[model samples]
Target: MLSKRRLTGTISNYRFYAQSLATASNSLLGELNDWETDGDLTTKIGKSLAAIITSLDALQHFKAEMKRSPLMPKRRNADAA
Candidate 1:
């Protein structure tokens, strides 16, 4: 079983990672605006950015669920083996 302190640290790390990714994404958008490019390249960049944001969102959701649920990673039963 994971201790409460360790679980809290893990969740905090996830939150920090998500926030950093969001900030980087915003920076990418700003650079794209400055580039003023159009068509396929722009579409590709937009799609990639969207994918990254979606992944971060999923991580955040997972972290929230972990906090709410009683579930934790199953430990090995040495005696049963």
Candidate 2:
């Protein structure tokens, strides 16, 4: 029974998290490329990539849930009244 505002806030938060995950994923990939010769560091970067992919999946699931929920109403003119 989440309120519209709460639901919207949840979606917004997830969106931010998704963006952060994407950024981290890109950074990790770059690091992996640079450290490919270092086996240990490259392995760690690969693990980080997997973690970020999982996070992105979770965020997408949250977004889908929000889309299925009947929370946000249709847009209305501010001065219609």
Candidate 3:
């Protein structure tokens, strides 16, 4: 089992990768528009990229909530006393 810090780091890394991929996807879409061809393919690829970005966003949010949860020992607030 990974430590809490390691787990959090892994999630953060994934979030960063997703963000980068989204930027690349947007760039590709822009190039497609400039070429003024294959609009249908561009739309399909755009939807796929959007879905990936949305999913990753949700995952990052869930990871944040997990870190804040009372059940996570490492994240427990000292002020809780």
Clashing pairs in 3: none
Given candidate 1, what's the lDDT at residue 62?
62
Per-model TM-score on C-alpha atoms = 0.48, 0.61, 0.44
Candidate 1 Cα errors over 4 Å, as ranges: 37-81
Question: Ranking by lDDT, best first?
Answer: 2, 1, 3
- What digit string (tens of lDDT, one per residue) describes model 1 on residues 11-51? 78777767767776776676577675554556657765775
Span of ten consecutive residues with least summed lDDT in model 1? 35-44
lDDT of each: 0.68, 0.76, 0.68
lDDT of 3 by residue, 11-76 (tens): 687677677667757766676666656557666667657766776677677677766665477845
Candidate 2 ranges with C-alpha deviation above 4 Å: 36-39, 72-81
Off by over 4 Å in 3: 1-39, 75-81
Error of 1 at 66 (Å): 0.7
Candidate 3 achieves a global lDDT of 0.68
